[model samples]
Structures are given as C-alpha cells and as structure tokens.
Target: MDQKIKSVFDLQQKYKFELRKTDSKTRIAKLKKLKQALESAEEEIYVALDKDLRKSKFETAVTELFFTYAEIDHAIKKLSGWMKPKSVGKTMSNLFAGNKIYYEPKGVCLIIAPWNYPLQLIMSPLISAIAAGNCAILKPSELSNSTASVIHKIISNTFEEREIACFEGDAETSTSLLKLPFDHIFFTGSTAIGKIVMEAAAKNLTSVTLELGGKSPAIIDDSCDLKKAAEKIAWGKLVNAGQTCIAPDYVLIDEKLEKEFVSHFTVAADKMFFNYGKINDEVFGKIISEKQFNRLDGLIKKAVIEGAILEFGGETNPESLTINPVVLTSVSAENSIMQEEIFGPVLPIIKYKNLQNAIDFVNSKDKPLALYIFSDSAKNQEKIINETSSGGTCVNDVLVHISNPNLPFGGVNSSGIGSSHGIFGFKNFSHERAVVFQSKFGMTKMIYPPYNLGLLKWLKKLM
Candidate 1:
C-alpha cells in the first residue's frame, strides 16, 4: 500500500486500541476537563467564530456554546445510568441462563462537522462519544478556520491525545481521514457531503449517524396567530443570517391570510434585526464564503428575473460575505427560490389555497431533519403530526424541536440518515450485542432418535 494509506491505517489501529483501553470513569473525567477548557475559552471561541462567520456573541452562545455546554452538562449528569448494561429477560429456550444486553463502546469514532454551527456540530457528537466511552477524532470544517483553531487549542489542552483529539486540516486531510477505518462515524453537514462520508465509511462497513440539512418546510395555517407565527419564523430566519440546517428554508402560508402574515412578518423583522438590533454586523453571523454568497445571489437574480417581489433583503455584500435578511413574495413552486435549500437568511412565502396543499408541499420534499407547523388548531396540528414523518417536529415554535433532549435529532430520506442526541446519541456510539441463553427443559433426552419411529412420533405429539 501507499505511504499515506499506511499512515492512516497505523493511526486507526492505534486509536482503536486506545479506545478499548480507557475505562468509563477516566473518559468522563476527560470530558469534564474538556468542558472546563471550553468554558475558559468562551471569549476566544466567541471572537473566533465571529471572525470566521461574523457570528454574534448572542448567536454563538445560543447556537454553539449553549448547545455544547448543554450536551456536556447533560452527559456529565447521566453518564452513569447511560453507561450501565441493559438487562433482558430470559426466553423459553434460555430459562436456565441469565441473559443481558451490554452497551459496549464502539472503538474509535470519527466526527466531521460543518461550518454553520462549527463549535456545536463538532462538540455535540464529541460529547456523545465521550459519554459512550469511545475515543474520538474531531475533524472540524476548514471554512470556519478561526473557530476550528480555538477548538483545537482547548481540546488539546484538556484531553489526552488518545481519549480525544482534534485533527486540523483542509479537505484533503479530512478525505484522507475518512479512508481510514473507524468504528463509527457521526457527521453533521450538507446532504451532498454526507453522501461522501457515507461512501468512505462503507469501505470498512463502519456505521454512521448523519445529521444533515435539507429544505425543511414551515407551514403557517389560517388558524395560526399571525403575530406569534411571524415572530417565531422571523427569529428562525434571521438567526445566524439563516445559516442553520434546521432553520426554516421556505414557508407555506394560507393564501387568504398571506398578506396579513407577510405584514406581520415585516413588523417582526423590524423588531428582531432593525437598525438598533445589532443582528447584522461583523459581530453577528455572515454567509460562510463567497461561493455560498454567490449561490444565494444567483437565486435572488433568478427570482427577480421571474418577477418575484423582494419584501426584505434583495442583495448581498460579497466582500464581507454578509447577506441582509431578505423576504420574498409572489413566489411560485416552479421558481428557483423554491428549488432547494437557501441556507442564507432568505425566506420565500409560498401561498397555498388549502392547508392540505401546504402539507403536500412539505411531504413532496424528502423527509427533513426538522419540520415546524404553526397553528393553534388541534385539528391542524394533529393533521401535521400524523400525516408527515420527519426527524423531529415543533408545534407553534420554529426549530425548538431540537432543543428537547427527549427527542432524537436527525433526518430521513435525502435530508439525512440515522439519528442522535440524548440517550439515542450516546447509544449511537454503542454496540448492542445480542445474547441468548438456553435451558435444558424436561425433554432434553427426547431429541436422540435411535431407530425408534413410533417413539419419535409420540414425542412430537407430546411436544
């Protein structure tokens, strides 16, 4: 084999053994140290993410720091119970023996995170890996290099090289790492890139949990309160300049109430990020790069050419990668605006003649990572909850479904594969081995058939 491949294999073998060598208590203490380092580096992390994507201190704390700290804190509290082996009842055949299922940590897991919520994406899975007693290798996005560097410094200082390590490099380094064998791979990013991660892991038949993004839909029913829906949707759209994977990508509003909803949305936008709101700045977030900005720019161009009216931000600042909060109206399903995930702060209002049409629009897309339905009506809420399938759902709130640790965060279909978070997150890195114990019943000697056809017939009848 080539030298590079040899080196990767060596690292993988070494890490796998290291993973099995550490006890759960040691791993938990390592996580505590990492968490303390993160807390100590809070200011540095905030500034770094801001420099990378202009993320605001509030947004950083809410989306990145808060989430990372929450996961760490939750794991610290529950690791003992979560790490205990699960006992199972003995079956009829296993009546004489004890049977139990153990949650053994899979050796050496790899986590690849995206740029949007750089710190959280990387650290959250790292939390799961540590909680499950597995060694982890964190490969953060190079697009958010400043924050990646800060993460590197904190983790290196806090964690032992074997228990946890941050690998800093570009796409080549990440791709190279993927080629190495991993016991489990947890990736959070775009579906396109997720496919590559899946394919690489397949070579070794490594299991994976993909937390990917798609055009997650938001439906505003006529029964919805325009004020409440507008406020929640506006906050979802404007946060981090709408770069979140779970952020509402497009909207489905009742046609008769569309104008009222848009007006309320305008009011809410003015309230959330007006001239005095401090949301739009180098301190707040920006689009990740010129390439992504240009992509959103292209969609805006297409919308304008198709006669779509801009209700809010119509253009982008390419120099600094800042895109103003743009709301579009007079949008059609055929327009480019409705084509795919507009990952920036651009929300398109899709008018629907009926609530079912809104449901159809969401159902038409692949199962999303997250879906939001804003309605006070029990009937409408029940329809959405029963009719659609997504990784998670939020009622009357946008993107709050992910906030609950009771729910697993992931997607289905093209949006993503597998799930994580909470107990599910820790178990995703665990190998659940099945065991069966057999007991010799009263008739164990009856199986021996030594040229006795009549006796065998009697035994079968008795059984």
Candidate 2:
C-alpha cells in the first residue's frame, strides 16, 4: 500500500472507536467549528470557486456556502434526537423484553464529491458523517483544484488528520483510495464513474451511496403558467451553466404551447442574464474545462447539423470557455443532444400532444435524478407522481427542491442509488442496530429444545 493509504488506515483504526463514542455535544461542537471555519474563509472560498468555475459571489453564496451552512445547522439541531435510541413496539415472542433501535456509526467512511458544486457536495455529506459519529476521508474532485485546495486547507486546519482528512489528486489517486476498505462510500458524479466506485466498494463489501446524475426532464402542461414555467426552467438551466445534476436537461411541452413557450423562455433568459446581444459574464458562468466545453460544443453542433432548429444561442467562445445558453426545437429522442445527459446550458424543447406522451417519453429513458412538472392541476401532478419514479420530484419549481434539508436528495437506478440530506444523510452513514433486553425468565426458556407435552400444548394455544 502507498504510504498515504497506509496512514489513512492506521488513523482510521486509531480514531474509529473515539469517533463512535463521541457524545452529541462533541459532534455539535465539531460541526460548529467547521461552520465557523467556513465563515472565516468565505472570501477565499469565493475566490477559489471563481477561479475554478467563474462562479459569481452571489451564486457561490447561494449554491455552495449557504447550502452547506443549512446542512450543518440542520445536523447540529437534530443530532441529539437522532443519536438517542428509538424504542420499538414489542412482539409477542418478546413479551418480557425491551426493544429499541440504536443508530450506530458505520466506522470510517469515504466521500467522493464532484467538481460541479464542489464544496457543497463534499461538505453536505461530511456533515452527516460527522453527525453520525464516523471518521471520514473526503476526496474532492481534482478538476476544481482551486476549490479543492481551499477545502483541504480549511478542513486540515480545523480538524485533526485522524478525525477528518482531505485527499487531493486525479483519477489514479481516487482509484488508489478506493482500493482500501472503507466501511461506507458516498459518491457523486456521472453514472459511468459511479459504476467504477460501486465495483471497487464491492471488493470490500462496502456499503455505498451513489449520487449520480442523468438527463432530468421538465414537463410543461397547457394548464400551467407558461411565463412562470419558462422563468423557473431558465433559472434552473442557466445556473452553474446547467452543469448541475438535477437541472432540466430538456422540456416536454404541449404541442400548441411550443411557440409561446420558446418565446417566453427566450425573454426570461434575456431578462435573467440581461444579455441581449452577446454573452454576459457577470450573471453567467464558464464551463469548468476545455474538454467539457468541446463536448458541449460538439453536442450543439451535431444537433444543428441533424436539422434540429436552434431556437436561440448556439454561440461558443473557445477562448473564454463559455457557451451561450442554447434552446433547440424539432429535436428527436435519437438526436445526439437528446441521447446523453447535456450537462451544459443547452435546453432541448420537445413537443408532446398530451400529458401521457410527455410521461411516456420520460419513462422510455433511464430514470432521471429529478422529475419536474410545471402545472397547477392537482390531478395532473398526482397522476404524474404516481405513474413515474425518480430520485425526487418538484412541482411548479426547479432546483429549489434540493434546498430543503428535510427532503432526501438522490437519484434512482441509473440516475443514482441511496439518499442523502439531513436525517436521511445521517441514517445513510449509520447502522440501525436492534437491541433487546430479555428478562431472566424469558418465554424462550419454555420453548427450549427439551419440549414436553405440556409445552407443546401451551405453544399450540399461543399459536
């Protein structure tokens, strides 16, 4: 094993017991310290994020820092109650026994976060791991080196290496870390890499929480407010340049509303970014890397070449690593843009005659991380909610569902596996142990191997 890997194992062994035995107060205190560290380093974090992804200060505050703080506060407030053993109802078989479920720590854990929303992804899961009384090794995506460096510095400064450590490297380093046996692994990235992480965890029989991404869709019905839907969809799609996992990848709209929806969406995009002619740098963000930019550019180019209408914005600036917010019409399911998750500012608007067509189209694809419906009709919402399955769903909104710490955020099947956020996150990092305290004269004694006629009669009567 590499020295770093060996060190991590040695530290985990040394600290696992202490972590598991940590009182609620100690855990809260640790969380508070982490919270304070983040506050003190807020400016540095903003700078790092801007350097890495060109995230504006306001966006950084809302998307990264504020979200993490909410998780911390939520964990701190709920940790005491979460740590207390829950009493369970007794069964007839344990008539004289007391039963309870204890939430125990899952020992050393690993959190592999992605570059998109880098800080929040890592810190949110780490908060739960800490609250659940587990030592952790956080591996931030190396693509966001500036943010990763800042995170490493803050965490190392606030926490002892054994208590919480940050590893920095590329895919090879992550592969090396995955070779070690961690009690649990929490991964957030593409489905392709999630598979690799799961396979590695299987080698050690490690429990895993994969927060992978797929092409989440947004359905707009005629009963809904078209302008409002366009605004929300545009906001969700343009934020982080639509690199977010749950951002609306495409729009499924009623065939009649297609022209109106595009017009409204164009207006909303222009108003949100205040860019009428050229791309605006202040409100918009650049792609994280040249490769990602090229990939997005290629998708847009192929869609246009295949005779799909570019409703608006297919301009790309290789030097700035930016692609203007794009809207496409006349897109088919087999179109290159529709074939994969478009983790960019490209939104394909597909026309459907009715609600069932929209639902059918979504179901035909791999289950998505999120399903969005922009309709005021309660009947439609209920029908869609019941018929389809996803990691999460939001009605009349986009991306805001993830802001609720009370809601468990994750994906299903190809989208993702396992949930996280607030108590769900705590449970993910914990093992619920069922405990039973038996009385000296337990009923089991009567049912022991030496069964007599009288005992058999009593057993039959009980049955």
Candidate 3:
C-alpha cells in the first residue's frame, strides 16, 4: 500500500463519522453538485467514451451519462424517505417496545468498476454511497483509460478527497486497494473477478455488493412475433456491441422458427447498425481493444470449427477493432463458446424441440443474471418465469428492466451476491442498525433471569 493511498483511506476513515451525521439535505446537495459537474463535463464524457470504446455520442449519453444523471435524480427525490428508520411490525417479543431499522452509513466504501459502462458502474454506486451518507473511494478500470481520466477529473473537481476520490490504474491498483478494510465494497465486472473481490473483502468481513455478469439467456417462444423479438434482442445485444453484462448471451428457439428468426435478426441488426447497405461507422461502436477483439474473433472461429454455422456477420477489421454482429446457428451445449459468457457482439441461436426442452437447457447452466422471454402467451411467460431463476427477467423485451430505478440491478449466486439501484443501492451501502426503545414496563422483563418457572410457563403460553 502506498503511503499516499493509505493517507487517503485514513482521511476518509477520520471523516466517516462526520459524513454519517449529515442530514438528507446535505447529502442531496452533494449529489446535486455531482449532477451539475456531469452536465458541465458532457462533451468531455462523449469524447472519452468514444475514444475508449468507439461509442457513439447517442449511445454514450443514453447508456452511461444519462444513467448516472437519472440515478442521482432518483436518489435526490427518494433520499428523505429512504433515510427514515423503518418501523417493524408489533410482535410478542417486541411488545411495548418501538423496533425500527435505522439506515446507518457503512462508513468508508470502496467501489471497483469495470471497463464496459465505466462511468455508470462507478457513479451509480457512488450516488448510493453519498445518498446513504458514506465516504467513498472509486477505482475505475484501466482498460477504459480515456473514460477513466475524464471520471477522475470530474470527481476531483466536484468533491473533496475525503468525501469522494477516483483512482486510475490497473489490476495492481485494485489489489492494493483491496488490502484496506473498508466498511463496504461495490464491484461490477466478470464473475471470475467478482470472486476475487469477494475473497479479498472476506479478510476483513467487509460487506460487499457484486454486480457481476453471467450467460443471460433469451428464449423465443413459438407464439412470439419473430420480427419483434428479433428486433428487441438485436438492439439489446448490439447496443454496446454486446459488452453488456445482461446482454442475451445466447438464444433458444424452436427449430421450426430458427430460419425465420435468423432472417429477421439479420435485417434488424443491419438496419440498426448498417447505414442503408453500408457500414455505419458512427452508429456502430468498435470493440474496446485489440485484445478483446481477438478473444471474440477466436470464439467465432472456434465455434465454426466445432460445427456451428455462421448465419450472418462474421467479418472482423483488426485495424478498427470492430467485428460485425456474428450470428451462429446449430450451436451445441458443448461448444467452447457456450462454456463461457460471450461478452461480445456475437449471438448464438440454439434450436430446441419444445418449450420444456428450452427451459431444461437453460436450467442446466448456472443461473443467469437475466432471463429474457419473448412471448405474448401469458401461460408461456408464467411457466418460463416460474421454471427458471435469474437475478431479474424481462418479458417480451430485453435490457429495459434496468432503466427503472425502482427495480434492483444485480445477479444471484455465481452471477452476483447483492443488488444495486434506487433504494436497493442505498441499502447496499448502509447497515440496517436495529434500534429498539423499550417502554418503562415491558413484557420482556418477565423473562429476564431468576427461576420463575411457573411465570416462564405462563409467559410462554401468552407468547
């Protein structure tokens, strides 16, 4: 641990108590400053995201910048209500006592973000931390260096070091930060890295909220409108060139509709990405880096060698770090591509004989972060939802569930351990301290020590 980094941690530690005592007005004011800072840095954010991921201005604004703004606004609107102590229902044990769960700040917090959606992943948790009155330190991904630099500048200009700070570095920086004992840690990245974060936090028994990724599946029921389903999936999967955590990793559809679905998907993807028969460089984003491009390229090639058929879009331009949306068909369960979460613009469509088979196939893998179903049939939707487990689900749609701040965004088990967004995020950076005010004469006094066997029996019966 560098002395300067340790000093930063020390400053936050010393200031956590003061921060925790702040009123909702104070926290909301801080959030407002952050929102204003983001507004002032809008153009810089666009340029940074474009340089880092080749993201279009519209995409950057919609996915990253706007998301951070919305989260801050949501926190401002709901801060007072969220901060109030929640009263628990009356019970025998708590009779004559006021039991409330107080939302206390978790002191100092550490936020480790991923390269994809770098701004939102880092800022969303920071908004929650500030809303809950906790001091924080942010670690942005090194892969997205341009975006990271912009974030560091914004944070530096908008906040004091003790209240909020952003550190820009690689894995070594992350390892050093994990050595400290922060009250809570919020991480967003792959499951493998999430495990490392969890293991590090375990050393100090620090609480954690992991927003990790997994192989989220999309199911196309026979009853669904093939064109609509294809369009929705195409937009969701290709929005960030499929670098999204909850993007549909693979699709399961009936063999009968496979051909038609592929055709519709190709048209939808082309219309969205290609500008009237030509590659729309502005609308389409390039891969983040050559390293990532190579990984995706190799996956496509390996899948093909293993008998998977490339139905559409397999061309890659290494110089530009962009791979056209590749669609694979006849992909088996054992294909290497199927073994890992494909965090790229590649979509694999697997044909199933029946809905039950699709459900079974989804269940065979680790529970996904999201399970998307494309169907108008209430019966099918309900059945698929009930039979499958995921952190969240979208019916007849994709990716829009995250837009609702009222809903939590996260995963389950191997996918992730905790939740974020809205009140869920506030609670993630807070400790639900149990506070009880006992009345002068409480029923619990009857059970306090002494051999009152007869009285104990009577109290037990009463309880």
Candidate 4:
C-alpha cells in the first residue's frame, strides 16, 4: 500500500469514532456545504463529463448533477427522521422491554464508483455515508479520469481528509484501498469487479453494498402503446448511449409486433438523437473509451454473423469514440450480445411468442438489475413482476424509477447486493443496532435458568 494512502486510512480510522457521534444538524450542514461546492463547480463538472464521456450539459444536469442534488436534498430533508430510533413491535416474551432499532454509523467506509455516471455514483453513496455519519474514502473509477479529477476537487475543497477523502488512480489505488478493513464498502460497477470487491471485503469481515450490473431486460408485449413505449425505451437506452446499468440490454417483444416496434424505435431514436436526419451529439454521449468501444463493436459484429439482423444504427465514428444507437432484430437468446451486459448504444430485439416464454427466458439467465415491462394490463404487469425477480422494476416506463429517491435502487444476486437511494441508502451506510429498554419487572424472568416446572408449563402453554 502507498504510504500516503495508508496514512489517510489511519487518519480516518482514528476519526471514525468522532464522526459516528455527529448529530443530524452537523451532517445536514456538511451536506449543505457539499451542495454549495457542487453548485460552485457545476461548470467544471459539465466540462469534465463532456471530456470524459461526452455528456451534454443538459444531460449532465439531469442524469448526474440533478440526481446528486436530489440525493443530498433528500438526505438533508429526511436525515432526522431516518436517524430517529425505529420502534419495533414487542412480544409476550419481552412484554416489559421496549424494542427499537437505532441507526449508527458503520465507522470508516470505502466507496468505489464506476465510470458510467461517475459523478452521480460516487456522490450518491457519499451523501448516504455522510448522512449516516460515517467517515468515507471515495475511489472514483480511473477510466473516467476527467470526472474523477473534478470529484476529487469538490471533495478535497469541501471536507477534511480525516472526515472525507477522495483518492484518484487506477485499479492499483482501489486494490490498496480495499486492503484496509473499512467498516463498510459501497461499490457501483460491473459484476466481475463487484465480485473482486466482495472478496476483499470478506477478508476483514467488512460489510458491502454492491451496485453491480447485469443484462436487464425490457419486455414489451402487444398490449403496450408501441409508439409511446418505443420512445421511452429509446431515451432510456440511448440517453447515455446505452452505457446505463439499467438500460435495456435487449428487448423481448411480442413476435408479431417486432416490425412495428422496430419502426417506432427508429423514429424515436432519430427524433431523440438526430437533427435534420443527422446525429445530434449534444443529446447523446460517446462511448467511455477505445476499449469499451471495441468491445461493443465486437458484440454487434458477432451478433450479425450469428444471424441477428441489424435493424438500425451500427455506424461508429472511431475518431469521436461514438457508436450510434444500434437495434438488432431476429436476435436469438444465444447471441453473443445477450451473453453480457452491452453497456453501449446497442439494443437487440428478441421476439417472444408468449409472455410466459419471455418470463421463462429471463429466468434462465441471471436476475437482472432492472426489468422493464411495457404493458397496460395490470394482470400482465403483476404476472411478470411476480414471476421474475430483479433488483428493481419499471412498469410502462424505463429508468425513471431510479429518479425517485423514495425508492430503493439496486440489484439481485449477480446483478447487485443491497439497495441505495433515499432512506434505503442512508440505512445501507448505517448499522441498525437493536436496542431494548427493559423495565424492573419483565416476562423474561420466568425463562431464566431456574427452570421451574410449573412456570415452564405456563410459558409453553402461552407460546
């Protein structure tokens, strides 16, 4: 481990006990200062995002900045309530004891954020960690170096190193950070890396909250309004050039509606990301890097070779590192594109004869981070939701579910572990310590070691 990094970790370890004692007012004030810093660095953020991911100013504001602001605001607004001890129901066995759950900081924490939505991912969990009164060390993805630099600036300028610190580097930096016994580790990134993080955390018995990604699906049946659904799906998939964790990796549509869906999807993409039939770089973002670009490019090529038709958008601009929104039709479940999370502007349309088949198909693979069901029938929605398990779900829409801070956002199994956002996020960084206030007289006395035969009989009968 680097001496500097080790020193920072030691500083935070020594400071964690004090940080855990901070009140909601102190935390809120810190959040407010963070918000102010974010405002001050808004232009720098935009420029950094543009340089790193080619994100437009408006898109940056909405997807990245807006989410961060909302999270901070939500935490500030709900911190007191969330900090209050939650009373738990009492049972006859403990009739004289008042049970409650007290939220406490999980000491020092390490937050590892991914490249995609680099700003928001780091800030969101940091907001939760601060709200929960934990000393945090942020490790932003090195792939998104520009945005990471901006984040380091914001964090360094706003907080003390002992209370909150940001380290900027490649996997080496992350590996060194992970070696420390952080009380909790919050990570948002690919499943492969998520596993690595989990492994490291296990060495210290460190608790972890992994926001990993999988091949989240969009199931569109005939019942949905094709045009409306197409438009929403287009925006969701192509907004960040399909680099979103919850972006529909592939569309499972009613077989008969494939043609109509393709037409609508193309129109939707063009309208959303084109001007005068030319690509609109402003509304759309470029692929993160040359490596990611080549990977996506390979997926599209392999899928076509294996018989999936390129329905729309396979054009790539190497110089700009941009791949236009791709739509693949007649895609097989076994296609190479379907094998992994296509974190790019590539959408494969797979036809399904029956809704049950679609559900079964999804079940055959890893549970997704998100499942999108675009159907009007409540029965259909209920059926899919009931039969399938995902980290989260959206009905009749797409990624908007993540915008609501009131909802918990995460994945299941390979997709992710644990949840974040709003109160759920605050709890993720907190330890729910169970507390009980016992009275002088208590029912538990009867169950003490004396084990009187008559009292045992009475307790057994009561149970």
Q: Which digits, one per residue and each the tens of the lDDT, describe model 4 over residues 111-149? A: 999999999999999999999999999999999999999
For model 2, the superposed segments whose C-alpha errors exceed 4 Å read: 452-463
**Which ranges of candidate 3 are over 4 A from the true structure?**
none
* Sliding window of 10 residues with minimal summed lDDT for model 1: 1-10
Spell out the clash pairs found in candidate 3.
none
For all predicted structures, in order, the TM-scores are: 0.92, 0.98, 0.98, 0.98
lDDT of 3 by residue, 1-463 (tens): 4677899999999999899999999999999999999999999999999999889999999999888898999999999999999999887877889999999999999999999998988999999999999999999999999999999999999999988888888898999999999999999999899999999999999999988888999999889999999999999999888899999999999889999999999999999999877668798888888899999999999999999999998888999998999899999999999999999999999999999999999999998999999998999999999999999999989999999999988899889988899999999999999999988867776678875888867777877
Q: In candidate 1, residue 432 scores what lDDT?
A: 85
Cα TM-score of candidate 4: 0.98
With candidate 2 superimposed using the best TM-score fit, by how many Å does residue 256's alpha carbon deviate from the native?
0.5
